[model samples]
Target: MLIQKVRFERSPKLHAMMTEAPYPVNARVVVQGKRGPEVATVRDEAEPMPGDGRYGMILGAASEADLDRWAELGREAEDLKWLLRARARARGLPVKIVAAEFTLDGSLLTVSYSAEERIELGALIQDLRGHTRARINFAAVGPREQAMMLGTLGACGRENCSSHHLQDFAPVSIRMARDQQLPLNPEKLSGPCGRLLCCLQFEHTQYLDLLKDVPRKNARVCHDSSGACGKVVKLHPLEGTVDVLTDAGMMQGVPASELRVLKGEPAPGQQKNRPRD
Candidate 1:
């Protein structure tokens, strides 16, 4: 598969694997760095990097040794975390060191953290470089990336999607919101990344399937009276009910059996509910 390096230019340098050869969902990558490397597998395929293409590097088909290096570095992730934290405090940088992971090849050491502003972390980088003898990178991860680094069980009682199965992060739109009829609350809609949840894409096909057979909301239908027409009110896909507004001057609740959909006309042929002349 086409592998990618997960380096946070504005954050840290963590190498990850793009699982698929050409890169598809949950594309796994082994992040390589000094102090050890990590395998930050992609839960989605790597897309073309936007803009100047300065996001991260890519490595093709790593070896077994590469994976071992990641495991070794993971062992000291906690210790390096402590060092970075102490260093940040002494340097008077208001930062929260979330987590740290080493690269698989020992070529780089990435420190993951979060902060309010872009704190000058040059000193911290220098310190880590000198101490670890590897390329030092300070990664400022957000809620989403943080969730990827420090994984935990999900609401479904399984590992978080980013940490386990999702390869690349896709753009979650308000369409998913409208489709689910969910409240337009950012907090409620967002996942660990502080963006729309990945699960929103799940079962989307099924929803589309249900909608396929249903008539359009604006569709017009005919009432029992051959001369009367009606406007579609609401649709019940599963129940096959098409509640309609009768064009007749008067209307009464009627079962769908008493109604026939109007065809071949923009407006209703018969007016069931209308004003008296």
Candidate 2:
């Protein structure tokens, strides 16, 4: 009934597994993963989770021999990765092999790759099968997943969130950048993956909440300090301020709290003429 979080060396995801006894954090344990018996590190202390049938039980604590074998497998996988790349190049296939992982039992080998378009791997898989006795599987990943697997730094000069802590990619769109009033320049708004920055979703809600109280751009408002009506030129949601063009043709930075939105007023540069009867 005790559940613990564990992470595999080849994956960034945290998987829950049943533990027979308590294990300290960072302790190595062997578990039956989807691929096969694999070594995983204990991410946290075990906790009770009743009726948890989704996870499999941990085989046992990893022995010194198991750790040694794990290291050997890592080196083998690296060699296999290079072999795969060389084979692809020989075949004239336009693909970048990102990673290769072998099951603990050495019965299965999984390879991940990225490409501009879909590619038929029939010949490549056949070639690899001939090179090794292990069953070979190839997976194609998108630009974001490729970047995550590569573990590259993002625009903020920090590790990519997908590689560091994010369990899965969130749906990011241009609306998030626009809501935050960011410049629409693609080069500036994109991450190393050439996609919309994932951090855009982090503070989008806060920006929306702040904008609720601020006047929209080019709206008519009255500055309480001078009782002068002006047209809002820009909004500073983060600072709670708005730049206004006063009726006297002067620009002023006024706090949002001091301005009252004047609805139904004529727009700037428009005349409010009397109607003839």
Candidate 3:
């Protein structure tokens, strides 16, 4: 059914499935809970089945009946919100519960909330279980997930990364920033994930393509009779010009075609700079 494997909170091995999911590494699905139906975005997918012992769940596609049932239960989300708020206050816990969803069959209930510390939610779960006669699960998602769920305005004044269409969460390295010659500013480079933005990976291949024929910035080569040889400071691959700081105390731009790249160390007496004078 082209179901992708996904990861859920606490259940690292638990996977969710999606049908015709748009995002490359992400998808949105309706989770069926005992008390109500909830919507969740698929984080990871299981496909080709990685040999790794990672477990996954095929949260099969939601049927039309499931959608209608979820719509009916959505009306009760506000009531669930108020109940959760009152419970947290009674317990003297600083927490905020946003939304709640129940399964199509009203067998499961999932509550979405945010908090700083690990607050005990046993009483809350018990209350919900007793009243709804269904399984209650509380998921504490990070800011990244929060943004995905609630949506937000980004630095560009548009919708945040996940909402706009980012799928995979690849680990970005400082090496990538350096390669792109971007300033290492957390505010400038990081996304709602508080990590390097995933968009940086988009055009990286183009930069790599441009760099293949270019020489490193630290190449040394002899200049004319001036013996002006130093590290390469700049390179224009298309123009074939390489700017090098020479021993003569000046930066000279020379055509890359005119200079021979040294292999290992230059052989002695072959400086190519000593004139017959």
Q: Using lDDT as the measure, which candidate wins?
A: 2
Off by over 4 Å in 3: 1-69, 82-99, 113-117, 126-133, 156-158, 221-229, 233-277
Clashing pairs in 2: none
lDDT of 2 by residue, 1-277 (tens): 6899998764577899988788889999999977888899999889997773688668899999998988887788888889888989998999999998887788888899988888888877887776679888888888888777788898888888878877778899887786677888999998888999889999987977777767777789998789998888877888988899999999999998888778675432232121101
Tens digits of per-residue lDDT for model 1, 40-122: 44444455443442333334444577566656777676678888889989888999898766556556666778987877887
- Candidate 1 residue-wise lDDT at 231: 67
Q: What is the overall TM-score of model 2 with all chains considered together?
A: 0.90
lDDT of each: 0.58, 0.82, 0.61
Better of 2 and 3 by lDDT: 2
TM-score ranking, high to low: 2, 3, 1
Worst 10 residues of 3 by lDDT: 268-277
Candidate 3 lDDT by residue in tens digits, 1-277 = 2456444322323344434433345454564432334544566544554445433333455557756766776666557767888988988878878567665566666788888888888878876754677677897976566666666677778887665565644556665655565667889988775767766777666645554544556756765555567777775544656788876678888875556556763422342322111
Top candidate, metric TM-score: 2
How do the candidates rank by lDDT, highest first? 2, 3, 1
Q: What shift in Å separates residue 167 of candidate 3 from its native position after superposition?
A: 3.5
Candidate 1 vs candidate 2: which has greater lDDT?
A: 2
Could you tell me the TM-score of candidate 1? 0.55
> What TM-score quantifies how close candidate 3 is to the native fold?
0.57
